[model samples]
Target: MNFNRKQYTEDDLLALYRGILLPRLIEERMLILLRQGRITKWFSGIGQEAISVGATLALNPDEYILPLHRNLGVFTGRNIPLDRLFAQFQGKTTGFTKGRDRSFHFGSKEHHIVGMISHLGPQLAVADGIALADLLDRKQKATLVFSGDGGASEGDFHEALNVAAVWGLPVIFMIENNGYGLSTPNSEQFKFASFIDKGPAYGIDTLQIDGNNVLEVYDTVRQAAASIRQNPRPILIEAMTFRMRGHEEASGTKYVPQELFEKWVKKDPVENFEKYLLDEMVLTSRSQVAIREELKSLIEEGLDKAFAVPMPEPNVAEELADMYRPFAPALITPTSPNTTEKRFVDAISDGLRQSLEHYPELVIMGQDIAEYGGVFKVTEGFVEQFGKQRIRNTPLCESAIVGIGLGMSVKEKKSVIEMQFADFVTSAFNQVVNNLAKSHYRWGQNADVVIRMPTGAGTAAGPFHSQSNEAWFFHTPGLKIVYPSSPYDAKGLLNAAIADPNPVLYFEHKLLYRSVASQIPDEYYTLEIGKAKLVTEGDDISIITYGMGVHWATRLLQTMPEVSADILDLRTLLPWDQEAVAQTVKKTGRVLILHEDTLTGGIGAEISAWISENCFNYLDGPVIRVASLDTAVPFSPPLEQQFLPVQRLQEKVAQLLKY
Candidate 1:
């Protein structure tokens, strides 16, 4: 059979063959190394090289491509140095992630490549954010995101597709259906006949093709890119292919039918493409053998260079230093020429409005936020004031929306993501904890986002709505948590969080929104995120609390004047005011930790342990803690009141004072 040429030249065709050949040769060599114990592990892309290579080549060099584990062609096509890639596989300091993360789990901003996380589906939504940024900037570029039959089952897949269609984003969703998802066949994965049908369901253009055909894959993607440039919208491509090896080097392929392997081996992409090129007179057998020898020598030289590089040193300082970008929370005094009284919700609105005015790259997104002003009316007139482009409403897809915010951050754009209620953030926990929180630590990428969490349990919103889940994120190493008590702190700390370069969870108590008012400055000001405020002064006891607990402590102290106590409002949770806690502990010799979260495994536990360890010598009595009962927040008002620690706090304060 002879080959027919269209837009691409003879040289372009030869380059594509070389692109497919490199990954196959490299993986074959790596498997030998794996047996020799030179490399740790490998996710072989031996068979599906055409999809990664053709799709990457289809887009402009500047456009972004999010590659899956098997897409070695994406790297080699971009001409990334083989030495650096081999070093990354070997977990050396010269790798993209500095050996922080292994395998093809790292991204390179210079190459416009966003690498995949273990959770494959979330990257689809993150691609939306990247495309959204381009749309907002009117850039003529599209994003190509890769997924598989197994990963397509994740909720993020549906959410990302629907959102991309609604927002008119330019993204190419590539699904490589390789028959098995780590031993589970596609037969058990989804009942649907084809992923192509999903495109019409979401109003996106769909294409289905044989993934092994290199020329066909290249032509189809090239046309899709051209269509998106003229009319920006998402396109879904389902490539039917098969992986010859196991999921990883260790997992054997006994689960796969031997007949299936024999059938696919005959239709091998590399061998078939070589045959077609020979028939078309694009190359002779002599040239093909010479090319293989040259590539093998190159791979050997690159492996030698990578092997000579040293491994990362094992030390606390190095580990800690790589965890976060260099950042120092601002500390501004509350002194201003003018001040005004405002409610907690109004203060937050003011801060957001002022931040939008201050930062050109800042955008706010959440459900019911654009026209409806969110569930709480916090952004009542934001859409009109800032326009729809900046203040946008999102579908009820928490995980994808947060992933979108992360994608925007990757392009140096700051985002304020509102989780309608703090409880709903659970749906997006993987994106927040694994992707947003760990992006900077794994690589030198900044996830400049401030997640607004409407929290607390005073309202009768029940178990689903009322949850003070700050403790859930407090344990995460790469995130900052801030829970403000009053309007003044709310406005200041929020601005501070938006300004900080790391991912921050800003918790706003639902009960304090309209009930509490304070005299705040008219102009914008920022307070230190790691700093604590001394609300009241005393000499006998110390009341350490935050959010609604601050108000509870104040009410108890006002009622009992005999108990002269110091009230310390911990405006920030993750980077809590340890210095203030220790100082107050030494001065009073009595400490009472208070919070609205449940008692077991709460933030109070960490504070109590810290006080016990650091201030053990300064203790006059046992460290006391008063927190809500360790159970789901009840729907009944009476039970909720009983479950809360308002009454229990009074008893604990009295006991500590007596001790």
Candidate 2:
């Protein structure tokens, strides 16, 4: 039983013993609650407590920890109040997430812990971003991110590791390889001999250890933290262990072999550690018994108090209002009529410049954003002005980059993330739709992040590169979608999005970068996020459009002066100006919604549905929609032009005029 005692003192070993014991006791109580139907579900970490507790114990208290669903030991190690932990499982109003989230989908800003989302792998990239923020602030802190063997199969795992390695970010990617991913064993997951081997490919330091051994796990992580603080590089550690219980309470362990289960039970981390403490004389038999009884009593008291807390009030109206908090009307001072004109791209760059100047904590990250100034040159000269620390050039990892932005925003910093092309945003759809959009609603945590999506088609960029994917996010509730058609609106709205307290998807039309130009003010300004602009005044019909569609509709109206139509440019899509749309429709008595996105399931559908519901009586004719064909953008010049509804808009408007 002899071992090296130089790495940790007797007191440190006793603290580890207590940390491992607390989660084990809590989880056992959780299973009883589940059986009694007091809690809906339970995800046990009975046999894998050492990996979670040991690694967490090695870090500084203020350092961030993004735990996986099964890492109850992490909460214990971080000293998260047991009452709040139990209340969260009971779905009480006093829980960390205010009863909005159950299981591990909750975090504590005070404790510097990012709660786990059901999709655990995305947090790896978020941890990368957090570490990046620390590095920018010149803080010598590291972020510990956890994932299971199954979660490692996700693309986010690789993306996070790559970004962390390339930037030399201080992140520890810990893999709790617990033999199986639910019912599927590691043998079926990957052909690689060990998950640790994959780290070297990303230029990360790698280690594989006996996860069941608490002392070994703590010593390795302690050294890893020290090295990361000194050299600032990402490290991967694969902790070999087993999940003795089922994935969740309802998921029976029938798939596991009896022999395998028996083997792991004998190697139970908590029991094994207690025996080690006793053998090394670090803890007496009496002390071990006392520790167990203390945790049991604490768990019982915490659970009893948590269960007494009232359930959250079901306030649908309040939730809806809180979901999309209205941005204050921007006090836009009138500029001189002879203000200098700037291209759309220049205006966007100016907005970003103003944001960086306004918010000292703002960080801009994307592929080729730093030295290369981004592919579209939207961030040109940012690196020279702000330096690489603020203007980051990340690897080609769309999902992780967005996740990182989400993580950074959790620290009360603002992040403006650019997806090189809007179409590429689909790669990070899960993070956007699930993590970024849902963070605020689930936990009352605002992700003050702006995703600058360079969207739309016109340069014959083909299917993958050319897409107006705004419709994808239009259905998401907690996101603000803004698509500005002109230079003035672009600059104003970009500033507005950065200032908003929630995540905003700012879509910058790719074609308008050089094509559109207008006079804009030099001073800082912001526009209302959900407002619309009346581009042209007419009475016959209302042509509501945004982005490239605005130009198309304006051109069509100019061709037919005999048929007067009001062109209403909807600068924002998600929370479109319903009052303005109703007023315009009631005034004109006819309406036409236009966009570059596909006809089916596009933003047009929502607008059309709204007009039907609210402005039906005022409408003199049926609400019409003129949008791109229901197909991917074609590469050929002729096909691309035909695919979009630009030429067809003239004919559609002619038909609407007759109505």
Candidate 3:
């Protein structure tokens, strides 16, 4: 527990010295590699080795660590071989990612080291989710995420910190204040004096330390981390370091001032630490020199091995099609595990409960659901059963909620993030869309998290509240979106989302969350993800809709004469039912796509495009789209009704029948 143990062995001092020498030597070799044509461009972690090394030593090996690009010292401390790292720099077969991931692209499922993100600010949000999972699983572990002072300028950092603070997520937010971000300096990046001050704004305890002082950095961070373990909230430790190397191998260092360079070199982090160790008698000067030589030899050996490693054979069989799987049209067949008869929202609630029971690492936390049973009672009595540790209430900070959930999910955790109102999702778009959605594709790490948002326009929430933005995610890759219309579909798909390995955005229509009362059997059940359900068996036309729109479209179909509409509720939007849709369109000879979102691009356009391209032979009429009017929804009842799809449903039905 005590970081400064008053005395230490030669091995400990040598290890500390090695951490610095390795990162620094590697930084120089990176430049050599660039000049020697051994590698392409590179991003540097130079001049910031002090805190990374000290912080790594301070943390428990079992704890999760998510680092940004300039975290070489941390990686070295965690035992990532310098040769392997250099191989990544050279983009070779020996590269941990086999030429797929970028240099500094690092993750270890076994070591619990979460992937380092390329973007500066986004990873902070994911750190929260990872920590939440660790806590929910009752693991005696913590997570540390490193960011830069300049990264604080991003909205995601604020989002992540706020959520971690509000929900008491256990994690460390380390700011390596290296004065500059690429070409822009820290002062120009934000109005705040420092990143540490910003942490206090989010209710997180902040500590500013001399990042280059190994003992001081370790002592300060250790105390801060201990406090977080007890309170289980967020803590920000700003470590003042310098970026001695260029931002990357391609960067021109000519712009750096001569005076500043001289001053920084004189106060080199590695040399300074080495001198301190000698003064303190932790290691003699001879031993320090010997260790530095040893580090140089180690680096040389790794570099040689990396060069000697054979290139992987290229496979002509590996085509572009192997990159990803496109969504297909398929019916989500009911399975034995999801055989329970329950309403969609209830199924979601049960799925969450089941997930809690299934994965000890699963943690559920959000704005409210604890005692109030959620805004729609989707999580009624969950806190009583799971305890506050697993089910927690957060302040009204959507950014924080999602950010923290993201943090926990990336590490050894599975977080189920809940947004109280679907409309509130706009506040956390930075975290949800920019951070969680792209975490995996960008970093090659899986963020197994679920964001449950109660969506649609039916509850008369009016204007600011009612909107279907599924099109936003449907258009994006690396994110899975599921919108369920029925209790049965809801329960099954939600369970599937929970069990899936990727980040999933689960949209539960507010209208359907509690709309229908059905006899839900007390049994386990789940529907397959990315699949649709055929609610009706009419062959004249195919009505493709989801959430509340499916119910409304079905009602209109029942009321309209001669319109034997084959109703289809798309359970998942990202990997939607392309096969079932194609087959249904071919069979029915007509297709109509409906949703509660605005008519422009509201999932309907995609369906229409697919039908026109794939089912043109069977088309009797142009594909029609029934959705909320393009105008902003009105708060007034009459205007709202007119703007919504409910009022125009009959007219659309008549038109479809005529077609």
lDDT for each candidate structure: 0.91, 0.88, 0.74
Badly placed stretches (over 4 Å) of model 3 are 1-5, 134-139, 159-170, 189-206, 219-235, 249-258, 275-293, 307-361, 410-412, 438-444, 646-659
CA shift of 370, model 3, Å = 1.6
- Score residue 512 of candidate 2 by CA lDDT: 90
Per-candidate Cα RMSD to the true structure, in Å, reads: 1.4, 1.9, 4.3
Q: Model 3 residue 605 lDDT?
A: 94
lDDT of 1 by residue, 247-320 (tens): 99799899999999999997788888998888888979999999899999999999999999999887788677
Error of 3 at 600 (Å): 2.5
- By TM-score, the best candidate is 1
Weakest 10 consecutive residues of candidate 3 by summed lDDT: 319-328
Estimate TM-scores for all models.
0.98, 0.96, 0.86
- Extract clashing residue pairs from model 1: none
lDDT, model 1, position 384: 91
Off by over 4 Å in 2: 1-3, 324-338
Give the least accurate 10-residue stretch of model 1, judged by summed lDDT.
Answer: 1-10
Cα error, candidate 1, residue 250 (Å): 1.3
Off by over 4 Å in 1: 1-4, 329-336
Q: Score candidate 1 by lDDT.
A: 0.91
